[model samples]
Target: MTAFLSRNLAARASMLASLIFLTACAALPRSGPNKPEIYDGAVERGGDAQVIFVNDHVTRASNFTPAYGFSNSFRNASAVGADEIRAGDVLGLSIWENVDDGLLTSLGASSSQLQQIQVDSGGYIFVPYAGRVRAAGSTPDQLRQVITTRLSEQTPDPQVTVTRVAGDGATVSVLGKVVGQGVYPIERPTRSLSAMLAKAGGVAIEPEIAVVTVKRGNSTGKVWLTDLYAGASNDIALRPGDIILVEEDQRSFTALGALGGQTRVPLGNEMISAIEAIAMVGGLNSNLADPTGVFVLRDEPEAVASKVLGKPVYGSQRMAYVLDLTRPNGLFLARDFYIRDGDTVYVTEAPMAQWRKRIGAVVGTIGSVNSVQNLAN
Candidate 1:
């Protein structure tokens, strides 16, 4: 069937691409985990990598974004003026009452009636007699003037005040690598973002640097929460109604068979390449690892099938990108292939691995049965 061939071709192609992943991952020094220096210290790639060549062929390339004056649509300039107050904002109401000496029952500085006025849905607040004064769009000082003037009608001079309520709005959801998971209470309107995090007990250990995200509505922005903690980031202020989310740590992923620590790594928002991903997970156990076959089983067979069939039978369909990471140029491409939440990167075992394990299981079962028979006899 036409379907079957495409399926087989796709499978072969993926295996081959993974072949690139393995080959590329192997060239670096395998001293052990915590080899940040190996990748970052400028190493040369002079040796030949045993890359498995298959019908599948794709190469990738890219570089880091430039700093200064370049407009990244994702990172917008901070908002100004009343444009900052989003919906669901809770404001603080501070009232200063100048009590009349006559009305005070021997009490000094007593309020005429109520002290503070609460703002409503329409951004207006009604004081004791200053009924329905607009305050939402109005600045704190401006609102204060409005209240004072209105109260002046009753008292010769009524001292009034207005301020945003402390901690009365939506909260940030801290996911992945924190001790607690939920929306944290933000009591102050003008508090620094670091203060909000301090309220929720800061980030976890070795938290992925530059991997935190703040997502809301249609707007998603990236920040290095790890860097924020280490005093490396300047973009640390959290806006009103903003969600400050921490990404999952990197040590939660699974590395099977040949890997030293076969575990699941939590997904973070760092611009990390596949080579970097492999290094993050304790590197491969050289004795059991086959450099020519490091494969990342990210996509399922079903999805690859759809892609294959959708390709034109006449022209070359773009299968998928498999980079020869041994090349310096390949690292550039890996940076752009940003990984999202819940992505899986696998390192496949050697060809004869499963068969050996299967055979061992069968032999062990047979030996157990024979021993049982002998004991019965």
Candidate 2:
């Protein structure tokens, strides 16, 4: 009776363990069909879900928009050209007269009388004889000529020189994630944004992942540094008091599910196609991935969704995209289909992967039971 009771108890414990394992398997996220039919049926019998099948037609769609453009908010500073001297500029002025000591000339007066003068609100500078000449809106060379003409009236063979001692109004500030941070004087009439970036020791981040911004008073413009260099847009000329910022791109997409490893794929180029993005994450996992069930998940804009859905998808921006790589033409479409930032690229597992998973789980459960039986003995 004691031996019979012990066997009955062991049998009950094994049954209980089997029941627990089955329960756990049923509670898993997905089972049966490894890849859900998101393209044809799941999207069409939709409850606010948008689906796009990436193909030759979809690849040629003009739904993608550039992140940065020459919009009203973004006026290219290069179009405005270089920094010029304005009122409040401090000028270092010196006058020389080559002659015998006359009424206006003294032995030491030429060297001693080099005056540091600020351009007044009226844009004028004062000399001992020249008296309040308009210096505002004039270059140092232009002002020198004006001073020379005025001083020539009283002194014999008068020569004059003008240098900008302080140019607070005619300077650009290089800020944000750059190697150097300081106020750079805009000495030229036209200076490129690239020139300022070079002076600032380039950006801390790689050029591909750097976004260069130009802030001119109330107006501002931003562009990818890669775009700027690739001739997508003009190399904006900097203005006095403009703020140039080099910031991280901060745009990325996620690779999930059956990829080699889940990763955040940085949008390092002007545009990255779906195939390029997959390659960036080391392509999909060979053993586990479903070649026909590759999906690019994105939040479609209302307007873009309308084009794909044949009707307006108003409530939700969610979209699931399927790429059937089994077709010969599918590879071409993948190369052409642009991938936007914040997209989720997911490759569902092969049907065999699920079967393998179930087999592994069963084996593990059986192993656990045998170990328990050993412990009981």
Candidates in order, TM-scores: namely 0.50, 0.80
Those runs of model 2 whose alpha carbons end farther than 4 Å from true positions after fitting are 29-46, 62-84, 96-112, 120-134, 140-161, 230-233, 312-316, 373-377
Report lDDT (CA) for all predictions. Answer: 0.47, 0.73
Q: What is the alpha-carbon lDDT of model 2 when measured against the actual structure?
A: 0.73
| Candidate 2: residue 205 Cα off by (Å) | 4.0
Regions of model 1 farther than 4 Å from truth: 1-74, 77-113, 167-192, 209-211, 229-237, 250-377
Q: What is the lDDT for 283 in model 2?
A: 87
Highest lDDT: give the candidate number: 2
lDDT of 2 by residue, 44-140 (tens): 5755456667766666652476577345434433433232347777888766777766435576565435566888877777788877799877778
- Give the distance in Å from residue 5's predicted Cα in candidate 2 to where it truly belongs: 2.2
Best-matching candidate per TM-score: 2
Worst window of 10 by summed lDDT in candidate 2: 75-84
